[model samples]
Target: MGDITGDTRLQSRILEDVGAASHYRAWLVSLALDALGDEPVEIGSGHGDYAAEWLPHARSFTATDADESRVAFLKERFAGDSRVRVRKLLLPSTLDGGFSSAVAYNVLEHIPDDVAALRSMAAMVRPGGAVIVFVPAFPLLMSDFDRAVGHVRRYRRASLRKAFEDAGLRPRVLKHVNWAGFFAWLLMMRLLRGVPRDSLALRTYDRLIVPAVRASERLMAPPFGQSLLAIADV
Candidate 1:
């Protein structure tokens, strides 16, 4: 539910993205929901969809974005919630929030210097805290939509681990998710020409298709997937 720093593609579609894939976004949130320790800070917390879902489980949550408009939206959206704080954050920060957990979902791929970005997230967290990162995976699956969406690079599990290690964090939970999504992206995005907007087709996939993938992966972890989720310790 967050944005990538320095990436403005589909900037105006932040809310649309949240609305279109409501179920899908919820699926993404569920992966890291339990790992989010107290006093969590989420980077690039776009329109705050993930924040809204995760906040009820956390003691305190900070939602941040590089885009001012999205920051404003998050602030207004969470103004009544005392446990939530919204702010504008740029990458390579010196922030020291001492958060128990820091997270970035579909955010790090937009940063060219992902290791430095991970470091920035790690800096905000206290020792023994968690830094949970989720990003699109598989370079072969890179499509026109990914470029149009301003993704710098996709990640593999090993590379993602290296990034965490480079950022001086210890990776604990590293896994591939969305087993079927790898093939779906290959056919729909790589072979297809355009970016997908909010549509019944997406909603249908989110509802009918995604659950089966989630269920299968939960039963047995896939060797590779459409995305990599890494939970590291500071």
Candidate 2:
């Protein structure tokens, strides 16, 4: 892992915090999982946090990442799990396709050419299969946090639809999520200048605020949010 980036402590911290804010992220991951087919391939599976949730549902779950270090970590993490296979696959590469579904969570923004990346995801899936993606929403919310995480850009509903369309996929579901988190992000990252290190406040937001908005978002799609979830058929 040090080969990719010399900062081992940062890597360790990131892995440790993989699913800390699980209330909202788990909901999003579950939504993506339910949309997948039997043979689903999860691309850019960082730390295998969310991937672990859906692996049992997939008849053949191939967890892939372009980063060799991340793939190695995933392999070791799931060493005894026969249902999952971890592979090092750079996107838009010439590997065997014909998968039932392709999933990418919080990854499209990292790619400089997201449209091409989406095209590759669609190409990997078999016809009639779908490509599901979760991305940060609202370009206006592209804060220092996004840049710190190596995000090149954010996506709006129209822009997200256009990306899938440009990749030759038909958009079936596209909506804003984390409506409450949108305001929270604005307050913390923008107004407050990063989330305070106070653990109790963070827990309150995650345990209470997140679930409340998540349930409400299910009943009605919010006009704006901190993230977008899209399901596009190939």
Candidate 3:
């Protein structure tokens, strides 16, 4: 909805974080790819990062996004890789019941009609196929950063589960993540009432604080932190 694709600084920071999280990203990709099995289509494939990650595992990959520039970038980036294809697509209509599974990571919150979007994602998948989603959690933790990025809502497990159910999908897993970081974000939003402007401070927090919190995730479970992850079957 916003010109987020032009925010090079935010995009760089996000991609850097994704690349650094070998364990977490691998886990997420594994879940989605496993659900997909030999499926060949991917929905909302912004920048094709996840598509690249899952390419080796999938039989073929058709990456689609609403953003035409992103689609062109992905097409050029994966041009030599014949197994991957990129195209511009709107939800529900463009999807039109073609994919074996659909993945909408960190995308749903950006849409106002989150439930309808989930249904559209579900429609893309064939029967028995899955939809994997990731969203920031806790309304109390929503911040200026979220507003800038065009997030319509944050989520809790119950709300997330209900959303999937409303979309006619069966929720397989709905859990909270980033437990340690949750407290930090909560404090920042609820108490500080503003986002920190220091890039160095943010980097230090991500590099140092994230690992410690993620390590704690092994012991602690849902309702822990600031993210909600879900896998649902259509």
Which numbered prediction scores highest in TM-score against the true structure?
1
**Backbone clash tally for model 3?**
0
Model 3 segments beyond 4 Å from truth?
1-24, 92-94, 187-220
Return the clash pairs for model 3, or none: none
lDDT of each: 0.83, 0.78, 0.71
Clashing pairs in 1: 2-46
**Please, what are the lDDT tens digits per residue for candidate 3 over residues 164-230?**
8888877887788777667877787556775444455565766677666666666667455678888
- Residue 189 deviation, candidate 2, in Å? 1.6
Candidate 2 C-alpha lDDT tens digits along 29-118: 778866799988888786888778887778878898767678898999999988888898766656556888989887788777778888
Cα deviation of 59, candidate 1, in Å: 1.7
Name the best candidate (by lDDT).
Answer: 1
**Model 3 error, position 171 (Å):** 0.3
TM for candidate 2 is: 0.90
lDDT of 1 by residue, 40-140 (tens): 99988877888989988898999998887888889899999999988888777878899989899888888888889888888888988888999999999
RMSD of each: 2.5, 3.1, 3.7
Taking all chains together, each candidate's TM-score versus the true structure is 0.93, 0.90, 0.80
